[model samples]
Target: MSARIHKLIVGLTLALPLSCGGSDSDGGGKTAELTPGEKLCKSLQDYVTQCGAATPCDTALVQDCSSIVDLLSEPFMNGVSECINRGEGSMTACLTAGFGALTPTNAHTGLAASFCSECAFGAPGCEGAFFSEDNPDTAILGKAILPFSDSLVSEVSTDCATGLGCAGSFLSCTQGVIAQRAIPESTVQCLVDNLTGQAPPPPAGQETCVVEGSGGAGGMGGTGGNAGSGNASGTGGNSGSGNAGGTGGNAGASGGG
Candidate 1:
């Protein structure tokens, strides 16, 4: 099971470069001028934005949002590139296109939609998930996310309906449940502080998402046992002896005979 999981991780990492956008675009070449939202969407092109509907985004482009490591990979950046390319200078359109590109399978549409809705509009005091009150691009992004929010949350998880709030950090919180991993509170706070368009916070310990461990059913080998020391009496003894000895006399055997 461990080997299979490792293989899956490796396969995802290796296969991403081919199907996802490559690392070359991560550098600040042309993307320097884009807004944070635009940049994020651009970075995550292959993931499906829509699910549940027949005309949903492409399944192949959908990403496994379970691991932050995988989420931040080049494929995500390539998604940014694709988003930017698809946007043609409109940041909201780019993000919308980026989000719209993915089409999660029927089984995952509920999960995917829940995540999208939360990431988009669930954060508190942040005007929806991705935009702050001061963000100038809200007019464009805000409108786009509204209807998308409806579509995004068309399907919901049980816990999702209850926790309609962000865990302080929009991206971290959404990715946490998506990955089924838990994000440390400290980590969530730190990520929220350094996120795009936000001022940097004071130095802090690195935060992380704890991936769940896998367990296997196994049986332990049994060990051999040692003989206990005991005394053994002789059945035969000297005939007519004082102690009722039989034809053969013998002392009681000891030391685990």
Candidate 2:
């Protein structure tokens, strides 16, 4: 790598520990350890800086000079070293060429998130900046996560819709079977008696029970609850057979006197 690129990468990686909530004391919390992948990422960052500073590089130089750390596996580092030994261009040119090939794609979400987090913490004026927004590493992180987000959202929506439809149908069918079983007339009479017992008795002078429906209880089957007048409706009944059975009890037409 070019000296300038190496310098840039060193600056970034060294700053990362401090930027990512790391304290000076080793005893306080977990001491952060740099991983091989992280080291590679920093190395690639350095290469990009060097190349960008150098003259506009040829596409072939960019393609051939790509770093194993950035483009391929750790094992590819051997091949990368061989290419560097060949000395096709200045270190800056080779670094630039390799850096260009490490274009961000959604497969590297973790990498993209890491870079964004690092930038937000380390880079100036990066607070609240999204991968879509312009920043120092926009080209890198944006290319990685944006396409991934789109595909993931689409997949989740499709899966959720299918699951919801299946669950709703199963619930409806199960409730319908339960409602089909007839209840004994005695059970209904017992429910009515219990309900009336819970209510206050009529006054001694009052012979007939005069049901007075209050405005608050209007359209609520004398349950003394208000039906909401707003755009949002009150929770009245379930969508399945439970609703049908509840409504049938109140409807004189459905329940023969």
lDDT of 1 at 239: 31
- The candidate scoring highest on lDDT is 1
lDDT of 1: 0.35
Estimate candidate 2's RMSD in Å.
Answer: 36.3
Question: What shift in Å separates residue 125 of candidate 2 from its native position after superposition?
Answer: 15
The sequence of per-residue lDDT tens digits that candidate 2 reaches over residues 47-97 is 434343232222222333322122233333332233333433333323223
What local distance difference test score does each model get?
Answer: 0.35, 0.34
For model 2, name the residue pairs that clash: 62-97, 66-98, 104-143, 104-144, 105-144
RMSD of each: 25.6, 36.3
For residue 50, give model 1's deviation from the true position in Å.
30
Segments in model 1 whose C-alpha atoms lie over 4 Å from true places = 1-69, 72-79, 90-92, 110-257
Q: Write the per-residue lDDT of candidate 1 for residues 1-257, one digit (tens) a residue.
A: 69999999999999988764555565634545754334454233322232111111211122322222322323334444554444342222332334334333342344434444564444344333223336544332332222222233332233443354532343443434433435344433332222232324212321111111123223333322233336743333233333322232343334545
Prediction 1 TM-score vs. true: 0.22
lDDT of 2: 0.34
